[model samples]
Target: MPIVARANLSPASREEHLARLESATLEYPLDVLVIGGGATGAGAAFDAASRGLDVGLVEAGDLASGTSSRSSKLIHGGLRYLQMLDFTLVAEALRERDLLLTRTAPHLVRPVSFVFPFARKVIDRVFIGSGVALYDTLQSLGRRRAVPLHRHLLHDKLMTVFPALDGSKLAGAVEYHDAQVDDARLVMMLARSAALHDAAIATYTRVIDYVREDGRVIGVKARDEETGHEFVIHAREIILATGVWTQEQQEIAEAETGLRVLASKGIHITVPKDRIPAKAATGIITQTEKSVLFLIPSDEYWIIGTTDTPWTEDVAHPAATAADIEYVLDHANEILASDLTREDVIGVYAGLRPLLQPVSKGEKAASASTKVSREHTVMTIEPGLTAVAGGKLTTYRVMAEDVVDHAIRDSFPDRPSLTASLPIVGAQGYRELTAQRSEIARIREYDLVRVDRLLGRYGALLPEVMALIDTDPSLGEPLEGDERYLRAEVVYAVRAEGARHVADVLMRRTRSDYEVADRGAGAAAEVAALMAPELGWDAEREALEAETYRAHIAARLAGEQARDDASAAAALADAPEVPRRA
Candidate 1:
């Protein structure tokens, strides 16, 4: 097959997706209409589209704008689950991890190692070591190699690997391999992959109500969150992949959905890499009196905190409590000789996990959010509506395949799943494309590092990015502030990756929001200016974009200084009010 152009996902691309939806409307009786543009929703779209079925996916915000982008961004078998003797969850995640790291979405997922500091000498070492071994075994058992095997380290050897580690009371460390991802990018890729397979995908579209006929869900009434234009989408099958908001969606459906999804808030704080003394992929899992704490690493910073507190307030924006911050710092301080203060923090984010109601009594009530089942449940709440709840990021494809399979078995009764043998949009001949990297750099007259970065992130689609740079050599230059990103990256993000706003470019497409000190403030104006032509943004819209981005940076910085959530929210006082646009 011929190489496709960069997946145009800008307003132009949005127009294309919208056009596809209109075309589907003419066709009538779509096989699947997916709600929620999260990982599961995107994956379902891909699965359904690849199976020769008409599909439409709608999101209330930007793609991966919710919990999907807010994940810890790891693709791995749940090592902690092994402690609870949940072998099924571990095995399934391992298989998915293998698929992502190797065959399906290699451009977005790569292996990352973690060093678990051994505090105790006796049973803890044996127990933890056994778990890592089992984790490695599962990966090898999979069709593709997810990551390398785990290795044990002595105290002195561990110190050698991580020189900045506080040596006092450190017995040793276990080096185990998992995988890390740009979570938002992965979700966007899934949607794009679906689009490549002829799926209709739209962001900033909200479902206002369900269309019911004779006590059956037949379609939906949706309004563009941006434009406020209501349109009816009629589908033979509707799949709900909105996490945390599962119950709310069920209420809208008015179906006797027995499944109850509870939301638990998890907060993560980002600090500069230097703030943490240890360097060799350190992640601490502390056995707290009630729960466990994680200190994982992002590409540029250390991600700390993740308190599993039951939430009772707003589901859209879950705020982190002051106690949550204190809890994390206190636990991390136990291991570091030089303690971290509130000042060292650079970014803070919170996400809610969708927990499924357990069949066994007290499991639903007694379980904290972290302890709840990450395994998903698929149920036909009504004749045409299927609600899929309670799954982790690593297993999204499996969840999607399962959801589609259910629809086929009950509704269509003829189509079989073809997603397992199918590759995503960027996966075709990726290694061969990498082999031609020198020629690519020579063609673009760019450095190896810059070209490699694009290839790794965009895979075989790197040439598409380079072509734009070739047309305007100025696009080959690095973006301001975050010089690691090429100027063409911003263009590619909008034109090909379906990015709608400045936040989509910074936070998801490039990760400048998480990587840079100023959280992408320095380059926001330049990016907006570059995008103005394509988005048809006049002076007013461009100014709005710049101001909104600047305000977000200010709010995030101020939030770091505040001691509590109220103070943090107060810090956003200067944040520009985002003008609603269709």
Candidate 2:
């Protein structure tokens, strides 16, 4: 990795980015301007910038604050898609998965094993075994093998490995490999990487209207959510990667022709790893009546999710209703030796997937969200505007390339995507840092576990965060209630990552939103106070941000108590909104 200039997206740098966007002219406008700040949008920004083109990206909220942050956090090919006979999506996703696991983001993404248990001896094994074989074959064809091939295990052997599994109905099981990442952190890093490549990255900037001349889309009219000030962001081309809100953005742009996306709600519940024996079981998958059930494993929790149902309520405030929780628990309990109850759930979240609703060549126009194709489509919404929808987290880079390549191929110079070969900021020197984790801990005189956790979160950039500990040793102390997150991590989030609000730090920058028992309510004020100096906030502002975060937390909890989506959404009617900074 040769020396490439890097920039931190702090308050000052964010202002500079906004200034550049505000000052952009039609003649000297940005080569490409990307709308949306989810994975695909961030990926498009990085893709455009890495191609040596001038680009600017604007987001309606914090980075990865949408569907990007609310994923199953897996970077694998959808194994279920293989059963749908959608091998093209499976193969494309598998290649991207291996690319992330092996080359692009080895630090953020690592290989994890999954157990796909069979319900019958003959029929189940034969069909699923063939699918698993094809899955491995797809990976091998595109890139170097990044994970081990699937291997079969007998019923007795699997029971030894997964005692929590009800062995009475189990015929056998197959263990396979996949990869996972901190989904929100990946988007933040992507934006930062784009900035490193000279892309102007702006968050909390909502596009209010389009800037068009004659027939082609030229720029956009956007508002600064923090200040309630509106401005123009002129560009040669505009691309929309807004995930579940794709249709809304399209309607707002008045494109008349674009993607028709159906919002599908998926919810996940987090439980203590000990309660579920997630470490012993690794990750488990089984077929459910509605969709495939997955027990995703993380460091300290088991993330069990998700129901595939249509969402017609507010797109911004998707909640895990009581019935939704019950559905997940009942389906999961069907295979568990010891059943998990609502009492075991420490945190719950809901996310909407933008499943493309178009009728493809061989596929019928699916009636259910689950039946829809996960394959992404890129098309010109207008002469100078391009919009993309449908895709998984694993294939965001590919989607970025297709959209950007389409937007720029006719207008701008020809330069292919370099993200496949380029590493994100923290990935370059990661392995060496991991190897010296203990030595780094000894040098800093911090606990080894803390050093390990920091390394896992920040990778090669651990030193930058640890440097804060040197100036104020107090920052090294644990957060008020959540010892898992250090005070320095919250401060680093405000200073380096674009954490404009308290929720941004708690929910996205750190996993405290879903990882902690109280959803970071206890540490909200402390985190806000730590962020005050970096963001030039007064005491009143700090308290306001903290209170707003608390109110939002209360709304989420209250919503979880409701039995239906209508009632759950009503609980958020009073969910506090972040006020104008001025």
Candidate 3:
């Protein structure tokens, strides 16, 4: 019965959040407070809120600005995990994958098929066939039976489905179904949905210290990164889901209770659609050397090359080197008929993964990034603080539920999780709404693809986007350089999505920065100018935003030329700097 909408994140909303915090501090001492704004944190907030617990979520930066935004964006039951013979892990992830595609967020997650091209003639088809079969079996055990099972492809049919493949080397391929999602948008929506359930959600707010009493963790001493104001709000419990930054949080918690976290970095590159022929399909390819490669199709470009390397420098922005790019291109090119080079690459991003560590000897030489682990661990280092680590994006819900369960097992004796049946904000009537997508296009005065795409990302919330177009018809026009996105989305990002700067609008809200060839430079100034009035910026602010975005683009370009992290980070030294746009 405590549903709130459109949180009024206006100046008024900030005051309301503070007032709520103060009020809740005085009443019942609150239930749970979550830290970090990535996928797991957002997931934890939703889980706790749905369970009828008083919850507050604090993020030092924008939601999903870290590794969550830098993911492969696939929501599949990791097929490779099946090879590891981890059935329990595969089953749980598949269940969540089904929930996202069918019920929890039908509009945000969509089914995508991948083709695993078999190149060796001596390799038994049954060996690869059995793995695909197990992957399909896991899908049936999930809540939604929407995705179809894997099918064997004949040599002729495989070539037909992917005309670009060099059939001389390829024996045949297997086609299987998985799902893809807009990872950043999903986290933002989860935070918004948790807010609707009365969870306190604030971005650009950092927890500087944990306030402890005697031996129990009580609350936190935090500062608004934007305004530099410090405040305290005592709570019954805390949950940390900071992703790669998990170790830093543990250090802070360790000050009081001694816990540790390890960081692993994963880097991904984006190339033009033309670089990879359309027939490659969006699926995982296991190289002869045992390394896995993902050829994913994004809205406007093909995403390729993800190097798993240990990282120890510049955690804020992981830099991709020339060597990293070469390694990826070298492996991926082995299968393609038309080879790709440096010119085809458009964007590159890297993120750190937080893996639980026992501090192995020679950990540095272990290997490339460990295959993404399906299992997650939750630890209560002290009386009121809980830390979770080592989970994939697909299984965030289960991780969240477990974290909350550990946090409140003693405090909230009567509460049970309601998130399993709870629908995210845009999920209401999603099927029926999709059924009316054609009609909605008529009423919204947009093409069927545009309307459906918007609906797909925002779910029942397409009305919010359409309402902006209604106010200014010009807002419906596509962005200056990117036709796949509409100009009106810029206005919506600031007004409703908590996008504070141009980078937020380009990099996350729209993804035009990585998807477009020019890295969204052509549209940056126009978008900044349009958002100025809404975000309360002057001419100087607009100019600053434009410069900052241009620098981001240049740094990424320069990063490609460097052979290692030192040169890569140095290349970005003069690229341009802006306030962190949360």
- Whole-model Cα lDDT per candidate? 0.78, 0.88, 0.77
Task: Please count the clashing residue pairs in each candidate, in the order shown.
Answer: 6, 0, 0
Report residue 53 deviation for candidate 2 (angstroms).
Answer: 0.7
Better of 1 and 2 by TM-score: 2
In model 1, the clashing pairs are 7-496, 9-495, 9-498, 226-581, 226-582, 227-582
lDDT of 2 at 444: 74
Q: Pairing residues by index, what is the TM-score of model 1? A: 0.92
Per-residue lDDT of candidate 1, residues 11-68 (tens digit) = 7667666665544552476779999999999999988988888888998888888788
Q: Which candidate wins on lDDT?
A: 2
User: lDDT by residue for model 2 over 425-538, one digit each (tens)?
Assistant: 798899989999889878878788777678768989888888898899999899976888888998889888889889898899988888988998888899988999988989
Model 3 misplaced stretches (Cα beyond 4 Å)? 1-4, 7-12, 22-28, 142-144, 256-259, 279-284, 288-290, 358-368, 371-374, 443-445, 571-577, 580-582
User: What lDDT score is found at residue 135 in candidate 1?
Assistant: 81
Output the number of the TM-score-best candidate. Answer: 2
> What's the residue-level lDDT of 501 in candidate 3?
72
lDDT of 1: 0.78
- TM-score per candidate, in order? 0.92, 0.96, 0.93
